[model samples]
Target: MPLFRRRRSATPVPAPGPTPPPPSRRSTEELAAAEAHLSDFARSRPGVEAFIEPRTAVTDTTVVFVAASGEWTRRRVRSPQQAHALARALGVPAYDAGVVGYPQRMREWTRRRAEEDKRRLDGG
Candidate 1:
């Protein structure tokens, strides 16, 4: 089942009024806290680059960090523009993950993880 369900209503939907703030996984405070975390990661991690994943119907835009060794982490940001701005401020280059796709090291890391899981399940 979908995480968010729409309710059936007999009343007609109201016309849009004033613009509303964008929905986010974290509150404003939490997003700001996450920004600090990103900054720390960029400073401590080597060759880290930001990959901005576009938002879909289900979620907000996310910034994924791929280090030189392919280790990665992700956190939700308000939008792609914010992602780019934040990344630049941190002195890192940002790219659209959807457009350029993930780096080869990231893919290799995933493959290694899967292989390790299979080995563990097979008791070898």
Candidate 2:
């Protein structure tokens, strides 16, 4: 007589837990504070050119600044109003990068700056 072995059945897996709620968005005052910080930084930094770009999708908004030698920085803002105010404080023009697009001069400056960095890295 041949002995028969019984196979054990697979256990059912449990469903995933509920997702947590998303973080609350920042208030206008908080956005203003961030703008002020950026504005101050740009003013203190030599040769910085500030620009604002409106966000389309999930991002709130953005303000970007490029220095004379093309080093750059960017931050998310709450609204266009805040961006304009920040630019005014920094004494630099703000534009919608999506609409007006990035300036040709800025692009050229960035390219040249990158080349310079490469040269420095290569010990030229």
- Listed per candidate, the RMSD to the true structure in angstroms reads 9.5, 9.1
lDDT of 2 by residue, 18-64 (tens): 86644538776877677777877687777776677766557767888
Displacement of the residue 53 alpha carbon in candidate 2, Å: 1.6
Question: What would the per-residue lDDT of candidate 1 be over residues 1-124, giving only the tens digit for each residue?
Answer: 9999998999998998987656565899988887888888899989999999988777788999888888788988888899999998988999999899999999897888899999999999
Off by over 4 Å in 1: 1-22, 117-124
lDDT of 2 at 101: 71
lDDT of each: 0.88, 0.73
Kindly give the stretch of ten consecutive residues in candidate 1 with the minimal lDDT sum.
18-27
Superposed on all Cα atoms, model 1 deviates from the true structure by an RMSD in Å of: 9.5
Q: lDDT at 79 for candidate 1? A: 80
Clashing pairs in 2: none
